[model samples]
Target: PLLKIANDMVVDLPTPSNISAWWNFGSLLGLCLVAQILTGLFLAMHYTSDISTAFSSVLIFLHETGSNNPIGLNSNTDKISFHSYFSYKHLVGFAVLLTALTALALFSPNLLGDPDNFTPANPLVTPAHIKP
Candidate 1:
């Protein structure tokens, strides 16, 4: 039924000549969604979504580089700074994901829909529901 509606909608629309790369934005958005899902799954294997262990699990994965210190440096300081690097990388990935989503929406507004979701990340609190 949904496929029929989509086909009818496409038939009702006029096709554009010289379609831009923007036409491919849906695939890009799908790729981003897949990446997010896979990463979330991996994280979930070790993540305790409860309020107590969430932050600690993330810290363990991000901060555990190795035990070897080259110049007798303190492990704690190195881990702290390295964890910041991991955090920055995660933030950048999210930014790219958002950019891809925005581009898709701008080029193809009909493809977008909203579903109720938990609020964005909060280390101190647990979401009341988990979708999957």
Candidate 2:
């Protein structure tokens, strides 16, 4: 019954005569949100929630980064583009998301970290720059 109701809602849904990049981008964002939530759930299983350990845990995770990208699936109907074109279209969306993240990390890393983290470090020497 619930499945029938769900299908009925989307049954014969009309596609707009003219679609915009922004609408495609909006769907991309929705997909990204679902990916983020699922990945967060998995990470949360091991992540330290306590304030005391959260900072250290983040640093550990950062240091351990290599294969951190969450799985993503992109699908488009014949209306959007051909397979290769659809791939590049989604690539543009991914680029936009990556650029936003890079900007945040560069401009406001402190929003997620303490003043000590914002400080530059010389990895060659002792870790005196780190706050106690």
Candidate 3:
């Protein structure tokens, strides 16, 4: 019953033709939200009470990296067509984001990191460029 309702609401609903690439952002943002949640979950699982170990674990996760939408209204009311259009846009956005991320991680891993972050941890003294 619920599935039927959802299908009626989303999968078969009609959206306007004016819905542009901008509409794609809702779905893409949703994708980002899910990605962030999963990342937080995994990081929390990997985290530890020990500061040094946690720092190191986070650094490792950073270096290695990790492998890891919306609504409308009526015109002609071709929901599937609009859904397909939005789906394609969503996928293109993901692909572009993924490609850029992969290129940066693979080509310039250190580009975004602070120089001090890669340095060896020293319990005796805090680095001058501490992130906090």
Candidate 4:
């Protein structure tokens, strides 16, 4: 299949050929950005960006992944058309995320808040070094 039916990215990868180094760089940069975006999306699926947890999560992610949180091994194989399948998936994903966040906030308003917002981060204490 041309796109593996939108399931797999095996065919989607840009194969290097007789292109110039500069052209290759453009492809490389695009690939990097796509990978970065996908990585970010996967993280956002699990992590929330609220006050109290944000600082800890940011520090932990930096320390553990060295701020390079990966999207893991290539595994989207069966392939569908990106225009039809992925575009819809993107919109649905965003909708689901927003719906979930709205529900959570409505049901548990205090869960997403930062208790220490007024205090601010202390320069003397490094959150990355603090014990949980």
Which ten-residue region of model 3 has the weakest summed lDDT?
66-75
Better of 1 and 2 by lDDT: 2
Please identify which of the two predictions, 3 or 4, would achieve the higher lDDT against the true structure: 3
- Rank by lDDT (best first): 3, 4, 2, 1
What lDDT would each prediction earn against the true structure? Answer: 0.60, 0.61, 0.63, 0.62
Residue 4 of model 1, lDDT score = 46
Whichever of 2 and 4 has more lDDT, that candidate is 4
Comparing 2 with 4 on TM-score, the higher-scoring candidate is 4
lDDT of 4 by residue, 30-131 (tens): 456456656666677657555548899888877766632255433456333368888899999999999999999899887867877647767887788668
lDDT of 1 by residue, 51-88 (tens): 44777777776578534565556656554357778899
For model 1 the local lDDT of residue 58 reads 75
**Among these predicted structures, which one has the highest TM-score?**
3
List TM-score per model, in order: 0.25, 0.24, 0.30, 0.25
The lDDT of model 4 is 0.62
Model 1 misses residue 50 by how many Å?
Answer: 18
Strongest candidate by lDDT: 3
Model 3 C-alpha lDDT per residue in residues 17-45, reported as the tens digit of each score: 76433353357653454465566656866
